[model samples]
Target: MKPILTATVVAALVAIALPAVAQNASQIARVRGGASCAGCNLFQASLSGLEARGLNLSGARLRQADLSLTVMNRTRFSNADLRDVEAYGGVFSSSNFSGANLTNASFVGAYLQGARFSGATLTGVNFSGASLQRATGLTQSRLNQACGDEATQLPVGLSIPRC
Candidate 1:
């Protein structure tokens, strides 16, 4: 190929890659200094080790995000879309996930003590070996699939399963 043609192809590829790079820069910027990204669509974004504790991320679309090993304690994720998210080993203690869609999210061995999942859809979520102490509005089905203790709270007339 001629030098000009090679340069043109490289320039085209760089043009295509520039927008993605800029978008990633913005994502990093927004996560700093207790940023709150409400109503933003962050589906399938990897937010590992971002120190996003206590941020108000309500109504954000975090579907299939890799938030593993992140310190997101006390973050508000009410009504957020978190379907198929990989949050294994993440510390989500005291976080509010009320009405969030968490279908098929993997929370294996996660530290979710006192997290609220009231009215949240937890269908097929893996909470195996997770510590859900003092979690409010926890359904029996959710607890049955995960590891919890007697201190875990449940809805009215819901019996603890043989988990």
Candidate 2:
């Protein structure tokens, strides 16, 4: 009985520590590689200047990540947690951001042409100097909470609100 209890405690501790270990491994991989942490916990990771095109990051936790100047064209970010992410000057053209949490994300000068943001949260997102031409799933209510400028391009029939 005592051995069984110790084994159970060890199992529980391993389970609890696994996620942290995985997160650390993912961070190391991102540094060694080009920020390619698919389905990994990258919470609050600073991936500035990352140049990983066509990388798959689906279901990854990237909340509060700094992705400034990253080149992630055609990358997949579906269902990723991107709340408070700073993607200024990042080129994410044709990227998939479906069902991602993008609350308070900054996309200033980011190129998002033909990107898919279906069902993603857009509260307080900054689109200043960003291009959203041909982007999908954007609503007026969501845009109302976003900040954009004249240089920001929207989808057809979508008008930009005053910043």
Q: Each model's TM-score?
A: 0.71, 0.80
| Model 2 per-residue lDDT tens digits across residues 28-145 | 3674386566777887777899888998888888888889999999999999888899999999999999998898899999999989988888888889999998898888877887
Candidate 1 TM-score over all chains jointly: 0.71
| Positional deviation of residue 140's Cα in model 1 after best superposition, in angstroms | 1.5
What lDDT does the true structure give each of the candidates? 0.75, 0.85
Clash count for each candidate, listed in order shown:
0, 0
Residue pairs clashing in model 1 are: none
In model 2, the worst 10-residue window by lDDT is 19-28
Error of 1 at 137 (Å): 1.0
